[model samples]
Target: MKATILVAEDDRNLRRVLRAMLVREGYDVAEAPDGEAASAWLAERRADALITDIRMPKMDGLALFRHVRERHPDVPVIFITAYGTIGDAVEAIRSGAFDYISKPFDEAELLRVVGNAVRTSAVSVREGAGGEETGGWFGMVGCSPAWREIRKVIEKAAASPLSVMIMGETGTGKELVARAIHGISRRGKGPFIKINGAAIPPALWEAEVFGYEKGAFTGAVTSKPGRFELADEGTFFLDEIGDVPLSMQAKLLRVLQDRAFERVGGVKTLTADVRFICASNRDLRKETGKGRFREDLYYRVNGIPVHLPSLRARREDILPLADYFLARSCAEMGIAGRKLSRETAEILERYPWPGNIRELENAVGRAVALSEGEEITPPDLCIALADTEEEEATPEEMRFHESVRDHKRAIILRAIRKSGGSKTKAAEMLGLQPTYLSRLIRILKVEG
Candidate 1:
């Protein structure tokens, strides 16, 4: 069956043109002269996608898009706007609109975005009722094969009694993985305590991981149960284990082996009934080989290694992750959830996320707070785009014998193409000022 596209525009000429174009592309077209008409049409039936002007008679695209997201989340909505309403359109995109096309947009571009919206709508059919499959496995989200395989590994590892080590880059949700293991294990009902090895001072690691005696030091006025004691008969997560000092590693190793420790400045030995789950962005084996980490400690915490793929390595999860972040941020900030445009999604997927999921979450939160309208646009996510431009290199540029000049020129060309020939947008995408992009275009003799 041909996908049905509803076009809601007050401008008769633009509506007719869009209908004619969609029809030529073999789509069944529905026309709405205003937001009111579009809402009325939606009341009776559904279209695969919606394209509405930001400003329409009786109602507006922003309101209509919100209505659709609430009532028919699977039906993607796109906005049509003039230059004056670009900001409003962007806000709509962040709020949940599928995408938007500016006035005088290329017919090809329109068709491309509409096609994406239609494809997204079909994909939603498989996403169940929540617009995502967040299986009942500890708040973990993503439908990628890597994520699925990781879930299986987590379940198997959780069922075991051996200590587990989670390895991944910073912001790769290692802590979440640890919590998931704890939540699924037999000790799920017990306390799940965590300590950041990197955050605690080397001198205080002992006192923090083990109980401290009263008057242990000048500031020790009272005895306190350490992280391990707090997590007795439960799970203890040591994050950034690679950052733990060599001296502390020996003490930690002793506790893991003996399952006992003495309070600081006290002779009474205490046994801890705790499960260990260690995490680190660094390679523990390499650290041990370098004589910076204890070999014995490394082996003790690495009984089962669970490595998480970075966001860049699992590009398929980017959009779902973004949506998850947006929803969470919106809820936390008391704002409505936003959606990503296909164009924005493409940019996110193309970018190499060096900082991983943590970075993505921060970026989404920033976008949500800064976005003035319903949807998030490219500008709203420019901080991440800037980071991507600085650290990421394209395949063509990474090849041997690729000259510096050629790489620079290629970057400029790609940015321009990605920005649809808008120098300002291209500059933003490239993390360069508009004047710099123009200068480079002139110097490279590239057609702008």
Candidate 2:
């Protein structure tokens, strides 16, 4: 099928030029004089890709891009940028546009980017048709098997009425997983209340979880509902559940058992049909064994256990996640799209991310801030590899690692291609176990 490329440029001459370029590349071209026309065109027809100018008369490209993102997320949007609107274009890319090319762009470069956008759009459509969720499922960007399994668990847990307990290392996106469950569940439209068990003081735990009556304490100015009451018929996410004070565990267990609780100093008991979602970085089972956490409460909250793997275990997702973070940092800082240098990508993939996804995000954000040019290098990352008990690699060592990675990646790509994109067949061809081959592919970042 011929891919349709929509050209939305205000300038007629430029639109003609874009149309001609796309048509010559064998793409079916559609032209819109401005963003509004493009929006109207999209309302009735489907385009595989969109190329829009930043500044248009009615509904600017930024607004149009947002419209398309909400209405047609799979359609890749590219920006036709000028020197003056380069910042806006970068912001668009950060907001999830496919790509951008500055004015007076090389015809070849424009065609190459458009071709990529069209191919990506095709894949997205295929995945959507196949009932497979995209990488941006609930704002979690990952394609590794571990990530896919976590998502499956989330779907099952969200469908059930039982409480969900998410266990993971710190910075492994436990809260994010919790939120995803709530966001897709039957109670999705309801409020999602959250509290950190470790953040609240022991003395304030009851008031925070079960609220306080007027005149209950010295600072009680008025009656107020707590998180549980606030989250009635909704989901209450208790973060760091293992950190809940021992004294308060019994009260929590009672609430979980009965779904009824009394405000401080109040005789009347209130009931809330709230679903519970808890997360803990600490091992609650061990805590229970040590008598630090209540045994019954642990079982109550652990109705469904969802474990998020550390970032290092899902090496294939590193570069994709880095790109996600880079886009986010660029948007937050209002900077142009900055890429990771080849050497920097090698370093990121090799580093033992002790802090997990959060650490990687911070590293990317720091690099974005420290980077002066368009590329983020090792120095820009400023990561302390020595902290992982390994000396930082010299330039020669880094180059050697890159060379090895590239060679392995090439060989794996060849095997997969020869096997017609079957990893199992590819493993057979390579004379390696399928699981081990999958690991190597992930470690080498061979799959997009």
Candidate 3:
């Protein structure tokens, strides 16, 4: 698929030259006279790739780059540098610029690097969203070891009535864990009520959970069932449970222990039969220690902890999850599923996803909305994630090791190709002292 690149360069002549070169390579080019114009353009429409000059007027490239890092963190930016300012070029890269090229680089190099950058960014954005729990039981998107362990935990949790506490980052799908727990529990046939702890008012929290009778307050018209009563004989998922206000924690603690509550205006107590499942993005232990959360309440709700791994923690699931989101999002957006190129998939694997799954879903949706072709190419993804809001990939990039293995294999094949199946010549050509190549070649199981 052809990519749309937003180009920002102060020099009109240089911009013309670059735009022409990119157009020839079959890319959709957007031109901006300066950084300010480029920023406005990005705000107006998400560009697939961004190319800007470092020394442009009215928002230099660096300043623009920082802005992108803040506003559109996913959009990857490249700095165009003259040959002498190699130091500045290097600095651009150091400061999170994808890559910079010397002024004299031919159109081929420009196209290749720009194409790579576009592909890398696009994939990152799409896969980054895979960390979310969009995929539940029927939606669980992977077969990774981490996910497999999670499944086992869910199965065990499902068979019992023990309260569950799920912990993970924002997009990691803590609620999905709650659902899985409900699906497996004996009360799986019953209603599953989900309430966001952070979404409720502190004052209304008790009433929301325990119900209130008529005249409970000025606005109370009649008695109403609370979430606990509604979820009786079933599961109740409390999301962002750590956000529960301190003043209300004591009352909540008592309800958990007593497994019953009396309506706000009624003296009669009502019993609850709901299976409690709590989800939190914070460390409950830390919160408990900090005196912000009740220690007794923590243990009560954490009878069985279901830990959801972050997207980055389960790298093997990235592409599969990305493809799933791609198809789902495309369908929702009234488009076709865009195919992923092998190279683009590799780029997805290379980056660390700090935002986890939710970020990935949003990126995929954004890509689908902005898709310009049948396939979701690397460039398409890059535009979605370029700029700054760049999610941090795991510090230990797995792809580097994968690349090393790939490069080593390529070198062996090249030596043999250059030697015309002559092991001795290949060994000598490869600079191996003697029969070392033969031994190495055998170990590698070279086809030739």
For residues 340-434, what per-residue lDDT tens digits would candidate 1 score against the true structure?
A: 77767777888787778766766677677556678787656653343223346668755522343454565566667877888887765544557
Q: Mark the regions of model 2 whose C-alpha exceeds 4 Å error after superposition.
A: 1-135, 383-387, 391-448
Clashes of 1: 11
lDDT of 1 at 142: 85
Which predicted model would earn the best TM-score?
2
CA lDDT, candidate 1, residue 124:
41
Q: Compute each candidate's TM-score over C-alphas.
A: 0.58, 0.59, 0.57
Local distance difference test scores for all models: 0.75, 0.78, 0.71
| Model 1 lDDT, full chain set | 0.75
- When sorted by TM-score, best at the front, the candidate numbers are 2, 1, 3
lDDT of 2 by residue, 1-448 (tens): 4788998989999988888888888999999988899999998778999999898998999999999987676688889887788768755553456667767677865875676677667544432111112246666889899988998999999999999998887777776687789889999887676666765667777976787786787545445466687778788888778878899999999999999999997899899999999988789899999999998999899999998889899999999999998987797578999999999999899988887886787678766855679998776664223223337888997885576566567666766887799998777555455887888877768964
lDDT ranking, best first: 2, 1, 3
